[model samples]
Target: MHIELSRNSSVKLYLQIAKTLADRIQSGLLPQGTKLPSVRHLSSLLSVSPVTVSKAYAELESIHLVVCTQGKGCYVAEPSVSLHREEALDLSWQMSLIDYLPRAQLWRNFNHSRQVPYSFHIAAVQPELLPTREIINDTRRLSSEDPDAMAVYGTFEGDVELREVCAVHLSERGIRTEAEHLLVTSGAQQGIDLVARTFVGPGDVVYMEAPTYTGAIDVFTSRGAKVVMIPMDEQGMRMDILTRLRDTHPPKLIYTIPTFHNPTGITLTTVRRMQLLDLAQSYHCLIVEDDPFSDLYYKTKPPLPIKAHDLSGHVIYIKSFSKTVAPGCRIACVVATGSVLDRLVAAKSTTDLGSPLLTQKALLPFIRHRLDNHLVSLRDQMQDRLTTALHTLQRFAPAEVTWQAPEGGLNIWIKLPPAVDIAELGRLADREGISFLPGGVCYAGGMESNHIRISFSYTAKDTLEAGLRKLCRLLGELLDRSVIMERRPIL
Candidate 1:
């Protein structure tokens, strides 16, 4: 039998040797008739004295686990084994306590993937715009040059070379950061989870805009934190209300999607951005900025990121390239310093060790090559798509419905009449072969129900107007009725 032992274990060497062999016997790995080695042979194999091997054999015999013949070797005995399991358990009750992201009917019908044949529910680059051939070439090239890219485990913080490159890229965007302060994450989703798990606790307050990313709401709430909703204005988070909240209860963290805010597509103004930084520092609250759309801007240049003005590391900035860069790459980075950075890295370690090194290395060269030329084409095409979608909405939408043309982002948030039934609207829209994100899921308290988020990034150019017309028709029908009925009973 092949055996390995730990000298540092508290158990005696003979007992350790006996347990290992006994386990193999009970497991049926060592068959009933199988012969163990001679005492001297086993002693030499285990690098122990013959007396230890004899004692181990004697222990197995005393337990009736093995048969020792006078001249021959010891053999495994037939084992009567029993494994206990709870076939009918209250697992649901236990899971209800910690389960986040349960599959609901809304998402079951419309997911991030292309499960639905016709969809506007997800935001991603069109297939034509994605650098498929280039990505393949880069992956093949990396595999040939550095086999370790796939063979070895990446550093806990992720690839050093990739981090250096990311540092330079962030510097160009007005965020003066170094490689040491950044931890590469699977995507912005994990970045949010890491910050939430590392810093937030049960009953701690986490302030976020009323209508923000649904994933953030789910993460914080599932962890038992009290997620307080801050109101949002045209510019961004309402600073006046934020200041009042600060005076009463200082939040553990303030989560924001500052530039091209999710669902709403509203970018925070430069003045608001500065004010947010000051408030965060004064309230002793850390800002978790989830930024995935700043690079996807259209006409006007978006204001500097809230992290750009952070002089004292009050902000943990998360930027994802999964939507803008190749979707399959699943790449993003987190920028923070001090204890926040240290804890986030530790949290990330428990999440997946680190994002796959092969993905990081494979995309590194492609990113370097695409910075100028490929990005320009990408931006131009997305801008055209957004323009087409906006025109379509304007042409068909009724006078009462309104939407803000975002500075740069993939989504256009449509505001329905407050009385309109959003759930019924979603069901009808699904029947029409179009899917979009209902705004109710975006709220922490899940009470808001007057908005829907549609993406212009994934649908084809030719199908854009037709899909939008269908949505407008449905909305027009829903709004025409004096009282649109809600799917659930009014409380």
Candidate 2:
């Protein structure tokens, strides 16, 4: 039996063989109760270890795809029952979404990818890092003291007290805003959607850094806006290209993640931050400054958000606590001075009435009291993981592959050799039981690129060490194979 195996995958050899054999059984290529090859015979035929073949057979047995007799060899099993019927099901939506559906599908695929076990693609904080005890305390205290806050519908803009807390928080970060200007959003993604819906429309040009957040891209494109990609460097979004695009496109909004940028983990220089604000003002374009990872900085502290220097209220600043404080809190505050704030509030009304009152109320005390202490410890733990990941890469990665060391932020951006295919690498990684955010998913157009984002924030330190080594080994093997293939004579 010739069983094809993925040499570059992170998945173990036995599981791959098991899945392949199972597929053959399902397809009726292998009849029910058909005698299968002995472990020694299969191993010899496939050029794999007998132990691997035995494990594969064992896996098939566990899945009930095969049954082993006490004295005889393994045999294919009868088809088992399933909960649902297998049929072609497709939704015929009212709207013509031919152009838009691909984006939705890509977003859905990326989201589904996160469910894989031991996923390194997840950028959110680990569950162990969350302040569960503190939240429980806050919930109990709030339920006793402010039952009305929990039961009754809260204000549309958000609780005045929480808004006040957010305002003070924003002020500390150099974003000068009052409770009146602050609007509580469900999350940073919703905030981006609100801004996109309120301000953007069909054919309205939106400028963003090439490898920006996927949520921002979805918001812009789903609204039928033209998203123009701006290039980036170590300092952050390229101001030269931005100015030229501003002149060419006359963009309605410039969406940016200026601090601890996603995927790349680059921070905008203070000078560039100031310059970006100036460009936003001069071009009369709104800057959606999504600042989530700023607080997670492990190296040099980043400069203030563009909203901090918003002399004309052109910048909409959103600071999300979900990534750092709590994953399900879904609480982020938006700072917009006048019309932006009012429109966002109106948009909030349209998009699910408002964020749950209980979530807001429960988080208020935690934010007020426990956040600073939690962050101190959280930052230290993340720093250790970051150090471990880097050390692992140094020890295992191919000399040809280079990763730019990020000062802060959850991800390390790896620049692959130009000839390498990211999709192939991604499949290999997934097969090997590791998942990662391919750099293309970070861009506006979902164009495959030579960069890969490895996050150290989501997994355990031990998991990170092993996962990084596996990833590096996969890259090394792939790079070597590509070199060999390049030199081999083609028929």
Candidate 3:
């Protein structure tokens, strides 16, 4: 086998060697059970040390890619048929169906390529702004001083100090919850999963906003709950639709992002908030209020969370430090009252013993002191980016496209002409080294083909400009093709 080495490559030499050999094997260049050349012989051929070859072979053997008989040399292992292929493939298809089925019928007539990266991803938090150095220092300090804390299993409700800190922080937003009322989760994603597991079950009807957070939709659908989407306008979820659904369906849970909703960055007005609470109370439905991006409001102070207005024990408020602090830290808090908190705690205990104690401790000081200052800085940065993004879009984008300037969230929702296929545009952008999430992924029934959400949080200013240019170019090509196909003369 001929092997080449790059001295400047970031991957370890042995790993590179192993991967090259593995690829060759997978491609059938090396037949199954074929004996590999001796390490010393291979080392001589490649001009690498014997130890490097040995380590590579050892790794292959450990992974069952290769095997060595006690007295014989190393040989490629016989290809093992996956025992779980049928089950695994079935599960994968099932999950895909859960995601795509609701909207599959609508998509069937569309022939657009699904391979593209839709140029706008509205759901992701800005990882570049995360306080990495502070978290690392705090983690090191906590591990050095309190090794025992790291070793033991955390309490079922999660770290007490973290919960207390969350309580104090959330109290400012009008949620009067004690530490016991809060449960620390891996992140808000897990919080949603736990809430679904605790409250919803097979065939349970759950109410969510149209053009809602896609992640929440997946969680609820995966749990076998029937989702009912209430339409949303500029002021947020239409209270009338929610009320009608609540009265007719009698949903088990109402999931909504009242402050700066996901796809459309609309905030729920105070009157609408009260109306939702009233409907939930009258219907006896549990409300799962997800407010992950409420902290980054650009224009004005956001209203207090819906939970703050919950005089009745209907709202289960879930928020995350991931958006404002760090994504990898995976720290989120869920505040619920009475029996709801109790059941969620029990559900959480089953998922993992608890969330990482070190992460919880590292975040305590940051939440107490650094978070407020961080939000102010983040708000300023986001405002500047949002302004720049809107100007660029207005200048370069076609006149047919329109979007809403969100008050404080990381992304803006753009409405493209109906004929412009976003999935096809996304595939074209992917070839140019740009990635974006399609609007179809954000809707419950796969609707939103005419819309896409653009995020200014992750992409830098220069990259954003370049990406937008490329995106517009792709959109123009798609429109031309669409128009040509529509007007084609038939024989």
Backbone Cα, N, C clashes tallied per candidate: 0, 4, 5
lDDT of 3 at 402: 89
Alpha-carbon lDDT, every model: 0.80, 0.79, 0.77
Better structure of 1 and 3 per lDDT:
1
User: Per-residue error at 369 for model 1, in Å?
Assistant: 2.5
Give the C-alpha lDDT of model 1: 0.80
lDDT of 2: 0.79
Minimum summed lDDT over a 10-residue window in model 1 is located at: 95-104
lDDT of 3 at 380: 90
TM-score of model 1 (CA atoms): 0.77
The C-alpha stretches of model 3 lying farther than 4 A from their native spots are 1-122
lDDT of 3 by residue, 383-479 (tens): 8878888888888888888888889888788899988877577667768866665666566533445787777777776777778877777788888
Q: What are the TM-scores, per candidate, against the unseen true structure?
A: 0.77, 0.79, 0.76
- The candidates, ranked best first by TM-score, are 2, 1, 3
Q: Write the per-residue lDDT of candidate 1 for residues 195-224, one digit (tens) a residue.
A: 888988766889999898877776786566
How much lDDT does candidate 3 score?
0.77
- How much is 383 displaced in model 2, in angstroms? 0.9
